[model samples]
Target chain A: MFYDRDPWKEQSMKSRTSLKDVAREAGVSTATISRHLNGSLDLPEPTRMRIEAAVSKLRYHPNPHARRLSLGKSDTIALILPDIANPFFAKLAAAIEKAAERHSSMVLLHATFNKSDREMAALERAAQNQVDGVIFITNRAPEAKVARALNDFARAVILDEDVPGGKVPRVLCDNGLGGVLAGQHLRAAGHRHVAYFGGGADLHSTQTRLEGLRSGLAQNGEPAYEPTLFVGDHSPTSGRILAEEFLRNADQETAIFSGSDELTVGILEVFHERKIKVPDDFSLISFDDARSLHLFAPAITSVRQPVDQLGERAVEILFSDAWDQPDFKALTERMPVELVERSSVAMPANKKKRPEKQL
Target chain B: MFYDRDPWKEQSMKSRTSLKDVAREAGVSTATISRHLNGSLDLPEPTRMRIEAAVSKLRYHPNPHARRLSLGKSDTIALILPDIANPFFAKLAAAIEKAAERHSSMVLLHATFNKSDREMAALERAAQNQVDGVIFITNRAPEAKVARALNDFARAVILDEDVPGGKVPRVLCDNGLGGVLAGQHLRAAGHRHVAYFGGGADLHSTQTRLEGLRSGLAQNGEPAYEPTLFVGDHSPTSGRILAEEFLRNADQETAIFSGSDELTVGILEVFHERKIKVPDDFSLISFDDARSLHLFAPAITSVRQPVDQLGERAVEILFSDAWDQPDFKALTERMPVELVERSSVAMPANKKKRPEKQL
Candidate 1:
């Protein structure tokens, strides 16, 4: 692919077919052709046809950079997402685009699939093209290189997950609050022994959520064993493997607090094949609530991260006046989380003797 | 919003700003300034900065046509997806971009959200920008207006779902085979009574899948009863409503074939809430196994539409020789679907056994 040594990009940049070809074919001054084509003037049939014919024959398309250079403001915004196929990111992008439409800004979407290289590439592209703004979403904590690339952008928002060293304001659901909700729900259902499935042990969101989960469980005032942690990539495949590992080393964990819907899917699949039943053999609570957890066989209990709110707030922050603020890029705001109770949680038969804590 | 109407746009139409400013600032002959600014020649150093300062101060961006008069192709493709937030569409967009990247083409992305207005807006914008090609996707069957807009493009590929009157080549999954596979699986599971939870009754995919269902069921020489149709929008909310309706009227139905994973989610929620046991109370099958359905509580059995393949194929079709055919717009091709057996289906218990028929 690199075989195309187009070193001519810097010099012979005007060498294909000129609009003069179109003007000549259209039988008009280049001015008439330009103005008429641009909707500044209404030309009669024959002239319009001539211009259209020339344009079609030459396959002429104006360079966006030239268009932008002329317009003084770009008409497009670049959206960087961790994974487009993830329901959460997808919904977030959808919300952002809808909001952007109000501003008449077109979106140039790039899915990084949670890869650093892709994120950097997307940022570089956005910078070179001079997009109006950028909405960046990443799952894992990015490296310094990613942060450095992101810092070059005058307007960018860190969304959903984290970019540890990024110098941009972030929009994130209160992950710790989500953890507490899940933990409390499980504890109230009479679960003392529990386990957690999260993305990465070192992630800010994961750690905060973990702290909240422990707090929620402790509210019962019972000295339960330390909750087991199964940290991995936030994907169904990872969830499956983790769930399998948990099952193989079966213990007294009566309830499980899964970090995200992605993980829940994997865990559920493993338990299904193994003939383990939720709220019967074991209860489960999931986070993010991005997927259709309610439609699952057990109607999974979930901590609902205000995804739409996060997305909207991200756009708001991206377009905010804080870019000039000395402390703007260093700020991290946490939106609250709520739990949508469903049937996935249940009291362990052994723990039925213990009083159920009311929510 | 429209306040910034360039007043000079109506005057003389040639000068956006007075050339007097450029000449005065550059401290050079107006001829030299005009020549330099219009790419007519290169200017000396001090003169260049003086010109640059004037250009920067006035925010003088050139007209695109003026630039087009100098350059050639934009080398950009406009990709219009029904919903960018949809994982399937997002994945499709990703694949198309990856392919286009190899061709050194950039993509102009748009998310229509299945709205006719947005679709029209996107189409018009793509047309106005003179995009090299377009790849269109929509869930609802589009109208003649959409077809006309799509037709206006030199190259367009209708992807995933259908646009009935759109005169563009399409690449889609074999809905018929998917439905047939579902029918066959349900039949094998000892279910004579089934319901097709479909997206829309008017959709081409719905009809094709229905026909395939009939054919698949017909294989046993049983001349099975035509499957019941539960029509609704594809959203999970619609799925829930459909599920409620199904529960209210269902008496003989033993299994359900969901149109998409989204609908299946709604159905699952209602069933789970009602404490309905899948495969035991009613077997279930889903289409577009884009989500981790295998991670569902019962590990849902489903007719897996090759979503990745669908995305890649659409891109290929957008650039394929098939589009060269004069009759390409009239072409309808169905990619095959496969059935992934899981725990969602089970033999009917205490069921009035249907008379066994030889195929």
Candidate 2:
């Protein structure tokens, strides 16, 4: 039979030896054996030997799920993110995985692709598996149910972008500062009107970035006009769509504050196909400098998120011992982000044109 | 007790009910209960009802490990790849994860980062977890022990690159074809002499690609000279070092065939820093068009691996019913690749210069 070749057969058969049998053979209470097996208790050498001998005699392989039940820890963390194919999330996940390894924990990855249903399904699966902690990341403004599902976990951390109603510690890049930097750079480059290409209008990151952009563009006084908004999801395909729209509706906007490198790639593709030159035609600043942007045609200017730190800190909070502290869930950490000025941003082509009214 | 506030406490207490207790209450054999619970048995309605009633009465929650033990299936697959942060591997993983999801299986990810010890550790962990299948991927040529460990799995598929002595189905891109495509493209552009930037000299890809390059350059006649080799691990840093070496020893080689986009990025960085223009100072072609090469300054020409198909096929092989067929383990499927002709390649500037004696 094909099943006969299964290597796990013998192991499964051995695992049939019950904990009760081992306890009975060791002449100890079930609690003692359970606690000792999970390394939650200290036992004398003689007692430890007896339990070990009994386990060996019976060939008892403690079931991982039962051990999890007894210990209330799974040694596994669920990393729920938008997409693994995206370089930004992929790098973040790598950092989290490395950090989790240091804590002797494994990461169960679930890619939601920014869909609500998928997000909920991932959460349900994580809960079913009883992971010790969860690191939740989303690009769009999640629904209330998403927040509730996140809150259900005893140990959860919101990462990258915010989930408005989630009652959990958050590890995020300073999105506002990223916007401020982009705004200051563009304004300094003699751009009076700029376009903000974002993932979603309702997203916390989008709003926060917009707020910071306005402050930065104020330039110690009121600016001529607010930046125009062109919103789409963070995928490259969305970037293409937004770029087409921006090109068609171009009035006086000379610079773009892209929410992510993903969008910048798409925008650049469109611009390349149309023979539109960057900087000379439109200055662009991308956030989340996760890709090899420095090697691009014009060498893109970007706001570099502390991606490694953001990921490591998220895992750190997940495995931290301070979960029980008062108001611990209320904590929010905004890791610093820096602007990498490359060759993308430049002066507006038509300096004589007045700034258009804000949309 | 801190454990009192544990959210899983109530669930854990209920899960203490044993399978034997449910079997006894239902007046059935333990094997029958196990088979029925695992959906491996067809029972009468009354019998199924009695078992369900007893389970509900006992508040029994079947341990996932015990269920796996009874069924000889974990509904999990382990993906052992070099690095999750690398875009190529990350995209491949995303495709694998999506495909595995269609089969109702979960993925357990372990990033070895091209380290032998970590590779062995990941394999050991997968074995301990009793994953139903494994998809192993490594950048460098692995040790014999690594191949042996991979062979130990009943269902394992070697992916992306070859692992010599591995007795399992392999799903890989046709490296020879990729090389031939790159060579022909460069040769067509009037490039008699070329430099091949490779990851490792011992890697199967390197050897196969070099062979194809020779034949392609021959083009039904003896080539002017064989392509010189500058080897380094597939990384941007390696690209930079190789670029420096190429510049130092360069004679009449006006074109380069980079083994991966990773190396191409590094090469570009060095070229940019040194003010050496691509297709102007040096023509270039890259393999693994996994990055956004089209957006680069001079869009890079590349051989595009069917990355998504390779990943999907690996998972398909892992779950296929063909594992028991004769010669199935000896199967190797090499997916085709295509040359994406962009702006990277150009005619040699000093066509009159005699090809320097093959380095």
Candidate 3:
């Protein structure tokens, strides 16, 4: 209850000259003064001098927390992600940091390591801190409780993957398009039977991408077989386990579409240890080319997420004034994905091993 | 001055039944209760029950910020680093976060991008927030003003590289040993004329490692040539520029010792684009094997920094009770490094190209 009203807000309000007071004395909009103080704007010399004079007269030091107190903001954003060790999330954090700095906001990081309890704990802490906004990223299919907590924030954005029950603005890469690109690439290379490796079977990304893969494989209304699904968490350990299982149970799968680079690392490690050569033994494609995939032993081809754009857009949405609109909180923006072609994908060696009509 | 005394601390103290009250009721030390509440200690059944009973009777909820007020601490640590997008720093942050959680503390991240002004700003912000501790990391040789600012904190750590005048505990990788390993490896491969690509000419790491390289190269009283030095910041862009300069001005250098993996990425990019081959055109070794070096195009050899150990130790020292000791503030811990042998190092192809007895 001590955090219900930020204690700093109450103390600073009674002592400091507020931003509203400064704006009134300077005969300018509070927005203009804020933008100028944050070094995000340039005004006419006369206007700037007038604001400076007003600031000097009032002894109004624009401490970010104190200034933002008048606006009921924290000047901080809580960034909750599955793991920062993952290159994708690290890059996302960097972009978000850069974007937030432009608006004079700092990021507080909470790494949940894909645990449900940790996710809830981080959300609660964010709420207690009264952060101005929140950016939630999860690799797993989160529980409805997690979504409900996220919805309680004044401003929150779901990023990278989907949270099924969340009624907040969402920014995600086009996973369906990523799957279509992979399916078409594999199909063009004379591969019919493929395996889809995904993080979670119940995840929105996994389902959407799977449907798109089915559509892609069924070129010109031809009979399309559902690709074999291998479900695991988006981690290297899970990838290793799934790779081993796939190797043992293989019947006619010729190529593999890995859900993430984390899994690809595990699959590659297993392949290298067991002397199973990529493309020579099985053609492979990876998603989220956040790592230096181009420098890998066999320059991997991957679906590259627009990481910078996604991060910048998420922060932009969090700070945007459009939140007052009726449907703004329900908005979902999907960024485009691109395929980076390299040596990892090739014509499958077992092109002729499978029968044409196996039905 | 607003944060001179934490406002939350004041508010929480007046309203809540303190940890001291619980300790008094349970007939146990505050330390025991603190550790128990953080779930860091296992207690005997009777003692645990008594503590639980006392907690319930007093309605003493151990909210982290409120509970820590009694101990004159914040349940937060400020992690200031150069860049989070870099794999080495990202991995370091992950380790620090894991270690902090063991003691029920949270990490607040500040990425400075190796800028002096930003570093000072982050430190000032940490002081304002009255964080429990600070972990400062900078890649280049920092200004003296930066060191002075760091010295103001009661519990601050200098990590990775040195701050010239900071009177505080430090935790860094053994740069000398890393250089020795690289030098010895190259010497055994019959390379005498080597190049050292360093982050900065005046950086403590660069100087220490350069001395070690000289000593290692002079094996068994043999004459050691002063290796060529290519000075640049630890970044891919800088690496590319330095690599170009090294190539253009090479006289007899047959190998390179890169400062960090960030530089290696840039050098490798340049090499790949220029059709130069690792260990063929030039043998090379990189520092900070944080990236997937074993899976590189040539499987790069690198001196591996003990990143996890360094992070864990920094946090441990920050929370350690040794701070009251007279000499504790001057303590410095250097973690060991090892060379990861891979395909990147080989006997130089220009073995016979250099003239013997050039002097």
Candidate 4:
């Protein structure tokens, strides 16, 4: 016991008063005082006023350190995002920061770059620091380790994409609706055959979006052959690779509905180089209007996810007091998506000129 | 009498082996040991190794709190940026974070949204926390108070276009060269009556770029009318406003040299709405090729700032030991800019038809 003395609990110094003192003075129990301060309990008006007066008179400051020591948590939230260098993520971070500020809490910022190692480090730091809640954002679907680390949180929220194994609260844009919007717009322009270029084939977002696109296009034409599925990461490099594959395969698809802006960038580059043209050789509709699509040469039509709104709402959900409920941590909120019809989609050229090409 | 009364200087009831003990064993002075651990000394290899071995054998671990008490600075750096959501700034932050990690330091992030009050708060917190250095980034021109607060830092660097008024070191892209490159490209494409749409007119970047634009254009012919200047803060909203103004007052300008990708987004939107075709209606050149301009419909011609290089170099400068040199803090590094030519700039359409309109 020689070195086991508690340095912080020494009796020689004056200590901050506890809730018990206020409770005793107000002639109520400590439970009522704690619950009332947290705004969790609905006490009668006179009782609440008496407790408030007692707290004021006692100069109760409620030691933040002590509170943290007891609950193993702080009044701070964290946002772990992928590729802060991407404009979409950057805008999302800004939205989260603003919402966190409104909640009177500070935010711990971590950019994961979609790397498992970095994601682990961020989560480890958040766990070690006992952050109140964590909002996890990753461009690619994560490994099981990521989900495990995320599941370790007292409170966590999956944002923008689905984490297959986690039982955490989630806030996401409507991936299905986004795909449907893109498909409907492209189809209206007389495109019957389509291609779905997306992120990882196994990712929840990719799967959901592909299904939606199929459903959306199914109504507009004859019993269709399944849209060509091109699987790659949602990145410009991958987009280029997929586009090269699409061109070499001699596809019948007249239009492409890309999963994200990163993919669209790559596809456009390859198309430009091979002398392939948008709406002329192939139509393109990109998801994530986060980039300035209107500035593109053809002014791209896109499925516009409410990026700012998604970010803001994710933060709000993370900081909400509903975490104490058994079902709250398992809640999911899906924000809506919209279609931005620009110049990218046009009536499929040569559709009637060479009907055989349509098949 | 009330407290420990600066107990650091006094040898209390403990082992008598002090830092002096290590010095004596290593045959070096105590001052040398202090300097070596503080990372302020440059000792020869063998001597440094001998001192380190002696200290390790003695089981001497310097008290972190004692070191902090002596140094009057913490192992932290402050990074203030206009918008954390900007891709450029996010990449900059990542680079800064990586560099800070190498130095065993942490970064404190603050988003000012180009506001003065937030800047003041950020600077005050950095000062109160005794952070080692600060890197400030801003979009709009800041007030004198912001500059004064930045100057108060023990070490500070003005990053990007954030703060030109600070007396501290600066790391920025070569905006003048960027403008010069754009102007030259436009001139070669036979565009003379060029209009400039950009960020704040009061910004040093804007003024220098304008001067360079004039100089570059003058190389081809007599100095033209002061390139029609439309000023706004660097944002898409401002860009839209500037575009509207340009359309309303487009006298005879057949080409536009936009200052940033942000402003170009708004300008392109307006053109698309008005059914004004690029290169067919007016040629254009853009600055800050950080965005995916090559994927645009017409494929934009742009001046590419060494964005990654600029970020890495800024971090290198921030942590460099050059701070102790004379006139060190007043250092300014202008990283070079490169031009990426695409299809956006071409022969001005109206010039051939109506040369008299150019006058």
C-alpha RMSD for every candidate: 9.1, 4.5, 7.7, 11.1
> Candidate order by DockQ, highest to lowest?
2, 3, 1, 4
lDDT by residue (tens digit), candidate 3, B97-131: 88887776778889899999999999877766666
For each candidate, what's the DockQ?
0.20, 0.38, 0.23, 0.15
lDDT of 4 at B195: 93
Native A-B interface contacts kept, per candidate: 0.32, 0.42, 0.32, 0.30
The 10 consecutive residues of candidate 4 chain A with the worst lDDT sum are: A1-10
Candidate 2 lDDT score relative to the true structure:
0.87
Ranked candidates, highest lDDT first: 2, 3, 4, 1
Best-matching candidate per lDDT: 2
C-alpha lDDT of all candidate models, in order: 0.76, 0.87, 0.85, 0.76
Real A-B contacts recovered, model 1: 0.32
- Model 3 reproduces a share of the real contacts of 0.32
Q: Candidate 1 lDDT, tens digit per residue, A1-359? A: 22122222322222256778878877789888777655568888888888888887886654445555555456677888766677777788778887777777777777777887888888766764556778888778888998877776667788888887888788888888887788778887877778889888888888888888888888647554567898888888999999998888757778888988889988988887788888798899988888767657778889988877887887777666556668898878899988999888877868435443333
Candidate 4 versus truth, CA RMSD in Å, comes to 11.1
Task: Judge the docking of candidate 2 as incorrect, acceptable, medium or high.
Answer: acceptable
Q: Which residue pairs in candidate 1 collide?
A: A70-B61, A70-B62, A295-B269, B174-B335
lDDT of 1 at B310: 72
Candidate 1 CAPRI-style tier: incorrect
Question: Positional deviation of B357 in candidate 1, in angstroms?
Answer: 19
Model 1 CA lDDT for position A37:
55
